[model samples]
Target chain A: MAFLARIYVTPRADVLDPQGNAVAHGLHSLGFGEVTEVRIGRYLEVRIGGSDRAAATEQVTAMCERLLANTVVEDFRFELDALASDR
Target chain B: MAFLARIYVTPRADVLDPQGNAVAHGLHSLGFGEVTEVRIGRYLEVRIGGSDRAAATEQVTAMCERLLANTVVEDFRFELDALASDR
Candidate 1:
């Protein structure tokens, strides 16, 4: 089967996010006082050809752990949708 | 009112994604042959204090247009959640 994975990799809440802080500061300077905090992360869409949903889940999880996310400081989650069956 | 905005910024389908291509190549080299393609983008969480939904939407739309997205090469979409009523 063909599957599509939408992955979100975000920094753990306990971690200090300088980028987010900087963005919030910039927004404040731009006169958006209502803007409080900003957190930035990564979004990925991965297309995979796999046997089934279970198999795809395992594969995507491995991908997230091995390459997609910095598991020490960041956390990752994903949703998978079946695209089509392989020919 | 308090609102949380989950924003997704992605490269347009027609845009050239060298980063995606490179990541796909890396995955293939790492033996994840089932991985076909990878498109990478940015995810942002913005917390805002506003008067109402209509006001928040207008504010966020301006943020996207002016600072959040490039608008030329990327497209952005966001979902807003009301956090709580102000004290």
Candidate 2:
């Protein structure tokens, strides 16, 4: 089965996000006063050939831990979908 | 009303994604053979105070153009939800 994994890697709450802060400031200056906060992160789309959902989940988790995300400063989450049906 | 907008900004398909290529190579070297490809992008969570969903969407679209994404090389999409129920 071919699965598409959509992953999100976000900065840990304790980590300082200078880029996000700067964006928030920019929005305020642009007259977007209604925007209260902006947090930036990474989004990844991966296509995996796997036996089943469970197998695909395990592989994607390993990928996230090993390379996709910096675990020390980022937290990762994902959603998996069968690609054929979606297509 | 408070709305939460989840946004994804991805490099245009024609754009060269060197970082994604490097990560894919690393995955192959690490023995993740079932993984065929990886594309990297940006994710953002924005909190917006608005009178209604339509108003919030318009504001967020402007935000994406002016500050959230570099439209020259990227494409963006978003999903919005009322924050109260989600919380």
Clashes of 1: 0
Indicate the TM-score of model 2.
0.89
lDDT of 1 by residue, B1-87 (tens): 799999999999999889999989988987889998899999999999976999898888888888888999999999999987752
Error of 1 at B12 (Å): 0.4
True contacts kept of 1: 0.79
Q: Can you list each candidate's DockQ?
A: 0.84, 0.77
Clashing pairs in 2: none
lDDT of 1 by residue, A1-87 (tens): 799999999989999889989988988888889998899999999999976899899988998898889999999999999886753
lDDT of 2 at A52: 89
* Top candidate when judged by DockQ against the true structure: 1
